[model samples]
Target: MALKKLDKDTIIAMVLVSPSILAVLIFVYGFIAWSVRVSLSNWIGLLPDYEFIGLGNYLGLLKDPRFHIDVRNTLVFTILFVGGCLFLGVGLAILLDQGLRGESFFRSLFLFPMAISFIVTGVVWRWLMNPAMGSRMSGLNLLFDSLGLDFLVNKWHTTPNWGIAAIAIPAIWQMSGYTMALYLGGLRAIPESLREAARVDGASEIYIYRRIVLPLLWPVTLSAMIILGHISLKVFDLIIAVAGKQVALDVPSVYMWTTTFDGQFYGRGASIGILLLLSVAVLVIPYLYQTLREESTT
Candidate 1:
């Protein structure tokens, strides 16, 4: 059969999207390939002189003490941030779905942080968490001081994992609203008749949600988890901005950044970058496969 001729408007629309398509392929895939190549080289600075080091960079990365710490920090951060966001977002969405009076107002307030840049969020949170200069001293401190509770302002970001929490709080605050919106849409997709029938059948609110609502939301939860994992893995601005050269709190992304800029170890930095890319891919691939399998069965 002969193919129909393409319309002028259809051809124009394809041309409009072609630049974006080309941009993603060139910038994203091209840079990824370049970084992988650099990771296998012994390059330094802007010099092109490099020996084929094979897996030398990978071996050294495994041996580095900081690499281990950064990995630990990243995993810990991913877990807490993703888990906290899901729990908080889903919980809030459920509450808001119950016909709250100012639901729109509350939603706007919650989403405001997501609109702010990560750099701005980090800077603002840094000011708010400083033991001496933060709201701990200025706002809560004054109120607590009157009650003789002066122990809370000593050092907020000095503890090991606590510092991680300190940095993640702002991130969670920013992104949880977005997750809430996702859950809200999922919740809205549920039929009201089913909920009413469940209530008539003597199912408690908790049981209705636990059995009926939660299972149906699995697809949304999986998608949100993948996105949150990716964001958490790539988190560098908040950590670096708040901590500022404190390697004690560095995650892998921040480690790669500091290695390239401060330590001037381009090959090692590229290697770290490649490692992080692999880590995100590892987390994503299994989930993507599961999703695709479920879709096929359905």
Candidate 2:
């Protein structure tokens, strides 16, 4: 009788969730499969041509110079953005952990940036980093000139070759607060008794952090890296809001947009989309597996 009741409850629960499950299966995985098919075809115009061309689109991307530049820009941006976020986040987290007066105010101040939309951040930073000179120098350039730091006023995102790296500044600013929160949580999770015990052993604060706190915070660091890395990989709206579609600062997402929508090269666009998906999956899958394994063990 109990087994029958359990089966009836399971059926009711499944029935309740069936609509969401079906929606995901159709809209998400179904569309992904369709895209994969479209990517392998010779479809270029506003038509459905399911002719299989295997990996031709992927190979063309490998040979495309613009795609090469996209890859390079992505690498530079990801490194700077991820590195900057981690450094600033950890440092801010450490400062907050010191039990400063009005700690809530400071924490909210630091995190306020994260609450703002990335598009807004990009728009504001674009103005601040404008390469205009003299009378047109209205943002950071103006401030630098006023302070007699004229040397600091130069082309920001407009600088050739290295322009893409400048975009990382806004990206870091918007996300570092999130990383700080993550680190703060990790820091607080560490027992005070551990630090006290280390102090009892004649250990300095720096030594305790280095030996005890840092090691335990590795999981938090790993989580931050994965999240930041994925965000950097698929950045589109922020770059567009800041720098438009300049080839010099091109990343895969931006390139994919132009290729698909502007140029109407559906196959190539689908290929870029798949590559972006794969890049994010590469970062996320391992983390998910590790998390699940840890849960299972515990």
Candidate 3:
């Protein structure tokens, strides 16, 4: 009778979760498997051509100069975006953590940008970072010229060889507040007693942060880096809104979009999509493993 009750409960639980499980298997994993198969095929054009081409699409991407530019741009964007967010996030979080007057107002002000979509942020920053010069200059260039800082003016998103770096600016602006919230949470979680103890021990504020606080923030930093890394990798709408589909500002997500949809190279597009998935997985999987392991131990 007891065994029967346990089996009944188990069966009921399974029944409750089965729909969600099935949906994931069908929609998420199912589409992933389909994409993998398509990536290995010769499915170019609007019509599906599932002729087995092995790694042809993959190899072609490797030799493609445009794809090369995409890689370089992605790397540049990721580094700038990630680094800028971390630096600004940490700085802003520290400032807010001080319990300054009107702290809540400032926190909300900083976080306001995050509530706006990346597409919207891109649109606004596009106007702000206008690349035009002289009489055609407007936006940030106009501000700079009026400030008598002509030397500070330059082509922002159209700057040769490093235009992708400019794109990172708006991304950093939009996400830094989110990063600040994460770090602020981490900072607040720390005990005031520990800080007082450090103070009693003659530790300077800088010393405490440098040694104790910063060391404790490793987990927060790691989590932020992974979150921002994947975001930078999958950036599409932001770049498109800011700079359109320019090759100088191209990333894999943009390349994949144009290749798959515009050029009707479904196989190559699928391959690019797969590569992106793998890149994100590389960062996410280990973090997930570490999180789960820590949770289980606790």
> TM-scores of the models, in the given order?
0.86, 0.96, 0.96
Instruction: Write down the TM-score for model 1.
Output: 0.86
- Writing each residue's lDDT as its tens digit, candidate 1 over 98-118 gives 998999999888778888888
Q: Candidate 1 clashing pairs?
A: none
Where is model 3 more than 4 Å wrong at Cα?
1-9
lDDT of 2 by residue, 140-219 (tens): 99999999999998898899899998899999989998999999999999999999999999999999999999999998
Give the per-residue lDDT of model 3 (tens digit) for 197-232. Answer: 999999999999999998998889999999999999
TM-score of 2: 0.96
- True-vs-predicted CA distance for residue 1, candidate 2, Å: 4.4
Query: What is the C-alpha RMSD, rounded to one decimal, of candidate 1?
Result: 3.3
lDDT of 1: 0.84
State the number of backbone clashes in model 2: 0
| Model 3 CA lDDT for position 252 | 94
Mark the regions of model 2 whose C-alpha exceeds 4 Å error after superposition: 1-4
lDDT of 1 at 13: 86
Q: Which 10-residue span in candidate 3 carries the lowest summed lDDT?
A: 243-252
Q: Indicate the TM-score of model 3.
A: 0.96
Q: What pairs collide in candidate 3? A: none
